[model samples]
Target chain A: MGLIQREIERAGIATIGISIVREFTEKVQPPRTVFLRWPFGHPLGEPGNSAQQRAVVLEALRALYQIEEPGTIIDLPFRWRREKYADYLPPTAADLE
Target chain B: MDVTRFKNRTLARLATRFPRLAQRFIDGYQAQESAGSIPWAVPKPLRQAKLALVTTSGIHHQRQAPFDMNDSDGDPSYRTLNGEELFDDFQITHDYYDHTDARKDPNIIFPLGPLRELVSEGLLGRLAQTHYAFMGHIDGRHIPTLVEKTAREVAAKLKADQVDLVLLTPA
Candidate 1:
């Protein structure tokens, strides 16, 4: 996704991207990005939350304005899933591997 | 298959909700998506620029052919959608993500309503003639082709439509 965003940016059209995975997006940065710690499918916020979605859209566009340099990623303060992220995270160095 | 070791219900639910992520974590591996270098494009004001959005949520017109889920490396194809299309004319076909909510409310994946409202409020530049969608699961050797070929194709389409800014929403 970041690759395609970079290609579009190279084509001379400024591009902004929203990513579910910040680590992955941070590696292959688009010209501008908004990193949201959200679910896989809902990039603009949860389903049916139009106001929050619109706010997200505004923030995404606002990211374009605030970022003067390329490859800048603005992390949105929003978060989803009240579960302990560490609990859901698979053990990196454990019996699983 | 073993739930005895995990105590958190949310964690167990997440494993079931997105099996791909769970599998990757179990394997202790994830894709290294790196373009190596950043590409810069001068941006115009949001108020008057021609804005466009591209989603990887498998949204396409009802008349168009759906994405090829049979491809192991996933589909690199993209479909064009205009603002004028009815909400009923679109559907999702990607197998990777959970689309139950998206199916219930397409705005979860595609923000046509919010975008149109932005236009109505004059909060953004005019929308371009077309928006785009591609299945998000494309990987393996097809990655480069998608980056090179399909990206150019979409960029050409955007250029022809005089789009100045593009917003990419990845599912």
Candidate 2:
């Protein structure tokens, strides 16, 4: 959670948050943020794709190094290649009723 | 083109086997979003900073205490994972997010592999001896306790370990 990140940063330790949902991360405004277009459960690419996962992590750390201003967010160019079913589905709007 | 998708913690595997449970998950998820505090602290360069990793992926070793899944509000607890431990020894107890891939390769949730590489390459300062993990489904209210208390404790541990930078991954 970005809240936790902020608390840790407040303690004088810098924090880099890698997360989904750009809007949530935007609201939290972590000192440094790396936004990924991946699904809910997987932040560093798919489950076993080590190369892609490492790339995502490296990008996050890279952002950590490059971001100088407070609340800087770097959107990762990576995409979740497979179908994401866990915790993500649109109910066609009418389903809420 | 006029669909509505919400941020949910999980669509249980049961949701697929039972189908009808998906809506409940959505309701639970939307209720979890919150307004987080903004705090900023600048640190030294990455190559000079002592690094640590924190994850909301519910990761823990079999020997450590497990997160309580029964708590609907969230476990609000934390675990310390030695960076040296084998990835095979760890397990995830979270139900909110899909763990299928995480079960196979932990980099999906905790990127210790890349972290180690970074440290060795001298791109990142040395790794902190410790790391942390907790379940990510806590509601907005229960979260402050985690942030104010548990996380502070963890940060203290990081401070004790002389860590300067933390990479937090949220699922």
Q: Which candidate is the best by TM-score?
A: 1
Candidate 1: residue B132 Cα off by (Å): 1.0
Error of 2 at A77 (Å): 1.4
Q: What is the DockQ of each candidate?
A: 0.33, 0.30
| Model 2, span B1-171: residue lDDT tens | 111111223344544234346445544455333354456676677777788888888988988877877666888888889878849699887776667778888887888887787678767667877898978777756777887798788878888888888899987
lDDT of each: 0.74, 0.72
> How many backbone clashes are present in model 1?
0
Specify the highest-lDDT model's number: 1
> Interface RMSDs of all predictions?
8.1, 8.4
TM accuracy, model 1: 0.83
Clashes of each: 0, 3
In order of appearance, the predictions have TM-scores of 0.83, 0.80
lDDT of residue B84 for candidate 2: 87
What lDDT is reached at residue A63 by model 2? Answer: 69
